[model samples]
Target: MEFPDGLVADTFARTWEMLLPSGTPGTAGLPARKLALAGPGLPDPGPAADIVLVPTHPQTGKAWQPPSGTAAVVPLSAEVWLHLAFPRDRLLVPATGGLPDGVLRDDPPPLHPAAPFRPDARIFFGTLARLPAVREPWLRTLHDHARHRFPHSFR
Candidate 1:
């Protein structure tokens, strides 16, 4: 099944909207880039790397099939890792209290196996692994802390 770039963007935007808080007060737009239309893929240097969007089923572990015709694989400055186990709700920022920035360095938060994770956490990262991007090491550190030390919640 082939979906247009706009359709994919709409789907992605809708999912994010449901996950984000209502009345959060932010202008909305979907960031979908055309892969072929975009320039050639270059080696990512530091912060200029592109992120991967791994599509998978939560229970079946089946990777999602991208819609046909002009699949827009937008290259991101930051990494975006997707897993069914990841919490898509509110994220915990550094100001959430109870955790220092260093706490995220050495271990996984503990509830990584669960869903609807920490309130201040912005994204889901795996304890032992992370998408290979420019910030790969840092993101892996954060994921380690999440899977080992923090709590997990569900909606």
Candidate 2:
């Protein structure tokens, strides 16, 4: 298991970050995000179309654990992922690194470990794209960040 060994171009990432709002369809600001670990003073990013940037690779089957350095963006909705993870489908939630102010959220709890978090935009992002409530352009920002800012390479 290898992580993103390449460094994403800072300038290019900054460019996309700035242009994120425009690329997104509705909102003008970044979406609410939280850490992926349960710690004192860590706040949930709310039940909206929140995001959790997590370890592209996880350390356990639980929902929240510390990251292994590299990040895989998980556009999670607390209300939805919780409902799904609470009962069945451990694969529903990705393992995250930590909470905001650095890495990412502590949602779904670490009770039910999962199959290591991997970046599956087609599965995760595609789910968000189909939702009407998550129409804020900020979602698009995340999408652009994944596609443009952090590409496999410059080519």
Which one wins on lDDT? 2
Q: Residue by residue across 1-155, what tens digits does model 2's lDDT show?
A: 11111221211233433445454323456643322322113344233212343222233433443234233335334433443333344443455632447544446554533643344446555665687745566556556566664455323
Which ranges of candidate 2 are over 4 A from the true structure? 1-28, 35-116, 149-155
lDDT of 2 at 30: 67
Which residue window of length 10 is worst by lDDT in model 1? 35-44
Cα TM-score of candidate 2? 0.27
For candidate 2, the lDDT comes to 0.40
Task: Name the best candidate (by TM-score).
Answer: 2
lDDT, candidates in the order shown: 0.34, 0.40
